[model samples]
Target chain A: MVERRMPSIRTTRFSALAPLALVAALLLGAPMLRGIGAVQAADGGNTIESVAIDTPDQVRITFRGEFPAAQATAENFRFAEAAAPDAPMALKSVKAEGRVVTLTATQALHPTERYKLEVADPPISRDVTPSPWATLVTLFLSSALINNFVFTRYLGLCIFFGVSKKRDAAVGMGVTFTAVMIFTAMTSWAVDTFALQPLHLGFLQVLVFIGTVAAVVQFLDTMLRKTHPALHRSFGVYLMLITTNCIILAVPLLNAQGKVSMLEALVLALGSGLGFALALFLMSCAREKMELARVPKAFEGLPIAFALAGLFALAFMGFSGLDFFR
Target chain B: MSETTERPPGALQLLFNGIVSENPVFRLALSLCPAVAVTTTVANGFILGVAVLAVQVLSSLTVAIARGVIHPRVRIPVYTIIIAVWVSAIDMALAAFVPALYAQVGLYIKLIVAFAIIISRLEVFASRQPLVPSFWDAVGMGLGFMIALMVIGALREVLGAGSFFGIVLFKTKPLLFFALPAGGFFSIALLMAFFNALERKLTGGTAKPAAGGHHG
Candidate 1:
């Protein structure tokens, strides 16, 4: 009786929880690579928060903290392409307005190309620029990264831990979860905006969001069963299960206060979905590797998987200092 | 035939059951995410546990009282609606009165709508039992869950931060891993084993394995 037995981890059943937080970090970080210059600006009060390329000729840099406008020299900020580092874009003039630094490029930038705006490590001053677009965009963008349900909020844990045993299944479940999230997010936003807000029945959000999710899942289930039986048989269980995933419910609830616009809701859902999928894939791959190793009897099954998730979260913490543009 | 009929446990027994025998975290292995996420600190875990326990008791009582009227065919939805109502009410109140606590556990409170533990009790016991019995059942289960969470939280806080309930216990450097989510996993596992060992020493043996994993 004292001898321990390992809970089976090889069953292609499902991942236990979502890990796409890194995937979210990556997806959100994609925009960062384009501004790889700001990505490298570590969190020592020297970080750059926002950069605007209104015209390729002139770019505006906004700092989250204080940066002296007078100290802004031409060499302080170097612009680059695809972040090749070797090939730097020459600047025509450097102008600083408190925390806002405006750089005029010597050459016109390709409109389609993503530019990497590098800032040298120094005390960055908080310059205020009124780019409503940047502020709105980053607010929406960071939710996908910092506010992600799985990594940050720890939602969708049951599915993440259960279904992540197989990479393909995890990917499938993640995609289905993301699709449901986008639709549910949009529908919930509409309901909150039109019905709940005017009536002051904000407390009904949990019921409203859960109802929306359940109704969506049931509708999708019926439509799939009738229209595409084969596909339904393949992924229908996953579709139905998304209704129970906390991440999906959490998304709408977080946006229930009408703090984010409808577009931001959609973006956050998509980013969160992708992040969840990424975490699932990473976890499945790692769990698959566990098959070859001998695990202790006591720490087998959910225990070890959770331990791994903790490690995954810690690793994601490496990106803690990384903010939207910074 | 006479030996097969088991005597049902009393109200206190039901509550005691949640603490050890059928601990939602350690034994039943249900609703683990909140257990892991909120256990980073003792205060965090206790607050979440309180929220969940309150929701569970109210929802269970409601379910027990409404059991006869709910259609079996659509029972799942009805139960869901009941739980969601209670959870939402708590969610709103927390945000309004205890903004700081709400800021920390609001997501968890909202997410309680999806917890298998609360819904499972409604389905398994409350729906079939009398109102008084169901209420006791839920209270027992709630206390069990709260106790389990606090035990995990206290352990994590002490080992991770070298403190207990925010008080420093020693001068040693704390183990950082205990504070991380991984620490949550490890702490839960070891604690499960420890709890099981203690349970065995007391009661003869009816222990389910540690992390009696139940999939959604």
Candidate 2:
């Protein structure tokens, strides 16, 4: 009787967990589900993406991935009528040379009015949303507030959670982290552009970037141990662990891909550093206050901290997409 | 962790310990970053958890095999390098052969090198244990972490996004807070409490309180 009952109990347990197991199995199949032909947009092979209108009479349309000559035709390019969605506007002429396509409207185009340019062949802009390209001011704002590495993206979680308990420790780690990030970004950018790009050693990015971070952490550890013993004791180990922080490595990778100039790279690094520090500072203050609040037995410590972090993240969501004037 | 082991248990026991008794996220509270970050969706959580599982297993095997050779003083750096090397290799392989999957979780694959859980497993178990035990231990811990991540992801998705694995389950996001980063905290925290209570009940209320130290 006991043995028979045990089997039934085991079966019940298995049944209870079946939904979880099935969901996990389904998730594992996600790549294949989203894999082939998921979002293949049909755009004509034309090169023009979007036209920038300063004044609506003439606009400069840019082509991507090719030179703009020999593709577009006057008949192929038409602006939709102002009121009608699909009706083409009367065109004076369409001209293309080099990588620029010049569009001239017979009537002055409304600068504020919505206009869609129909092209027989167009670049894949319809399918692919271009990265919010970095400008000096935009990069600074984006990294520091909008696309903050910590509050927004969840990079550098290890330090963000661990050292962000005490205010002093948090401040110490944040300042050190900012300094290290700037230095490493500069160094890695120099190496990547001067040697790696020139030599076409792009495939070696992971190795080079990680190697640079590890070396930077080690060097910084030694320097701080000798120079600032007290600071080292507080969050210096956290500094050494920066070797493992994803922010340090990810920044260099972004810099390599972003193709920003030296000044831009430095600005981005500094902005990201400030952002990280800001996150740590805010989290630390919140955690400090959380100590005095009423809390459940199980929800104390890291659990509460994590919950607080989530709240902060929700708050940070308000800062998203604060774009500059293009 | 070693202090609790007076005698080495069987292979199955080691497996059970990882999934339940010493879960990397819940029991030990290591690698909280990925626990909160990638678990926004069930699919994402599974991908990163699998990546972590692979890295953990390989790192454990390598560390266990080299335990005798690696000097005590230099072992930490050596383990970190090994982890970084393995992670880089995996990242490249995924990008080269499985671009589709890479597109989903590639940002996470490189980040695994910094996971304190991987290094913690080495320091706590793999460094002192034999190869086979270490391998089993890693597999168990990896699975446990994966399960925890998935559970958190499912909750957040089901509540925050009104979806499961990006599938719209409900028309309205029931509690949008559950989907945000703050939602991540609530899910993990609440789920952790439930798990703690369940563990206490399973042990007939004799279980010692969980030491909330998660410094790793």
| Candidate 2 interface RMSD (Å) | 2.5
**Native-structure RMSD, model 1:** 11.1
Model 1: per-residue lDDT, tens digit, B1-216? 132255445888887877667888877778887888898788888888888899999999998888779989999999999999998888877789888877877778888899989999998888877777788889888888888888999999999998887888998899998886657767876876666666656666654346535442
Instruction: Estimate the TM-score for candidate 2.
Output: 0.72
TM-scores of the candidates, chain A only: 0.62, 0.58
Q: lDDT by residue for model 1 over A23-101, one digit each (tens)?
A: 4554465553443223224566557777666444777787766778766778887677654655877888998777788
Writing each residue's lDDT as its tens digit, candidate 2 over B79-151 gives 9888888888777877887787678667777778777789889998899888888999999989999998999
Predictions in order: lDDT: 0.74, 0.74
The regions of model 2 sitting more than 4 angstroms off are A1-134, A225-238, B1-7, B165-177, B200-216
RMSD of 2: 16.6
TM-score of 1: 0.74
